[model samples]
Target: MRYAQVYFLFLVSLGMVGCETTPKVDNPVLGPPPPRLKSALKQQKLKHAEIASRANDRKNILEGDFEDSENPFETPVITASTTSAESAVEDTEDILSDSTVVAMVNGTPLFVSDVIGVYNFQLKQAEQRMPPEEYQKLRRALVKRDLKGHVERQLLIHEMKSTLKKEQLDQLQEVLETAFEEERIPELQKGLGVNSPQEVEAKLNEQGRSLYSERELFLKQQSAIQFMAVKAKATSKFSREEVLARYKANIKDYEVPSKVRWQRIRITYAKHGGKDQAVGLLDEVIHKLQAGEEFGVLAKKYSDGTRAEKNGQWGWTRRGSLAEPEIEEALFTLPIGQTSQVFETSTSFQIVKVNDRKEAGHIPFADVQGKLEQSMINEARMKATKEILEELHAKAVIETMFDLDEDDVNSTNSAGP
Candidate 1:
């Protein structure tokens, strides 16, 4: 396959990685506000002053000083500062020089910091996946690739903004803010145990770092997929037939793993007179099971498990699924008709009777048709996005003059202080 085909295939396969394994999607910090509007405002203020001066000049000319050259307001046009525009342009240019400038479609002031922020996040991810020695070697290259990707995304975002309505932006902002405040923040705080507003802020700040990291991850994924979607639109005209074809080609990608329906009962060692006492109690429960008392009734009374009321019955066991080795071992070893001896887990003490077992099974295709269709849609979108980015890369005047030395971190642009 050609490089482009290989690239496209790699991008397609990337979608299959589990979200947990994927870097958390972090949103870019709105950051200290962009200076574009501020610059525009200052220019407007100057323009207003010039207009007033011109009006006065006209009055003076009408009053009799006919000197056109000396006129204080010769047409009072304040040329917007080229310097400011150039600075803004250069800031974006510098980043885009070594990276892909997707498109400044929306006229939003793109920032190097935003792309750099994203690059740092991807670097951290690379560091996590590789060994220390390999990470040190590959980190800069990885970061550069990430920056290239982000700049391309920024271009796409700019394009999207140009076409997208202001109300849409407003609606998106409102929805995201609601999610951040009402859902994400509260849940984060609850998990982190923040009580007061101050603690909440502090916790969020800590989480904010994490959030930013994840946002970069999210941006890459989103930008990649979006770039593909936009590309596919221009490349292969996707018809219902093509969608069906793509759907058929990638149907296996949509299968959900079989799940075992089961209930759990836990016996708390602390509640059952500490670990030693719990152990002794286990011996007694075993004896009762031998004597033929109903396992379910005894479990309801004695198991300190959260699901104790239901009985110490975990309905089924799927191979290689359970995290606890002891419980999993016992589940597989115990005869289907019998009960397990009291086993201690990291959290508590427990005895379980496998009231039933459901063998792992494949979900029927008809049952998952809707989900499969959505998967096809997403896949199609990705294909289109990749084509868009390839075009963007082809058109962009990217330059990577900056040295990325692995050994001399101090000399490299990527070096950390």
Candidate 2:
């Protein structure tokens, strides 16, 4: 599957499996927050200034206002500075009182509340399941990961909004809303086991979501998907000759390995009490086989292996794939439609019957041509999509708290005492 298709499916699944809402706490007379919370708050405030500074620095570097370093490979170290204790406290207090802006995509601000809202249920579960330190760590990691996705999504959305006319956008939105109501709502109703649209709405409300919000999300996603699909289709094209060349270059990958379909009656030494008892039991099994009892029936009654329930059938194994060297050797050499004498391995005693075998061979190009061509097209689509995203990133002004935090850490480490 293409990345965009997989991502679109993921979003759809999330919308279908809505998050459980966490109830807000309404306690009074709380003491100071934990050290981790304090640190996170401080970092959040610091990132705002640091991101702007880095943006200006990058702009200056591009404009040749900053001189080139003597060693081009070496990083230009950033000097660190200290903040006043009183100012740091004030910043922390402000963050506690107001929603911190965690990221910016173009001119749009993504608040910390917005980022957390996406994963509120998951974070709540983590807090209950993990220790405070571990939960804090996981929370940071989730934020960083989701923040990247949010940035990319916003970039795509911005591209879609900019590229389409207002009327065209409105038409697209109308089509999506209609489809959601006609197709998606029905599916959601059946999946949720609800009989009415009101029940579906109520269920979504229980998950801190509304039908309007879900519809809006659907509209934005469908627009982005349509834009990417159109872009990818325009760029991804391959000829028969190109596909054939790729096939010939990677012919070994298309080669089929030798395989066998065989059966066995395994008698583990431990299962029968010991090696001596196992040997005795094997003797009885061989006697029954010689008297012409059905091997499958006997295997079902006595075999201790994984396929014992399936009449000891080891269906279609490739050469060199089996861990049991003794069985693997016997598998290829044993004649078809015949049973072998009792064989002993370190852990077990076993007898085998070979049913069928296939020789190693290369797949014909004519047989796999269509699939190969499709695969090549998918690859090209992915590459085209990547290039489109890169172009978008170049044109868009994106800043995230995690990026600033990393920059601040690097600068601090570089500016040693």
Most accurate candidate by lDDT: 2
- Candidate 1 lDDT at 408 equals 18
Top candidate by TM-score: 2
Tens-digit lDDT string for candidate 1 (260-327): 33334466677876778667777776788789988777778777745667665554446678888777
For every model in order, what is the number of clashing pairs? 18, 0
Scored against the true structure, residue 168 in model 1 reaches a CA lDDT of 44
lDDT tens digits by residue: candidate 2, 245-361: 999999999999889998899999998899998988898999999999998989999999778999998889999998888778888888887888788888899899989988889
The 0-to-1 C-alpha lDDT of every candidate, in the order given, reads 0.49, 0.67
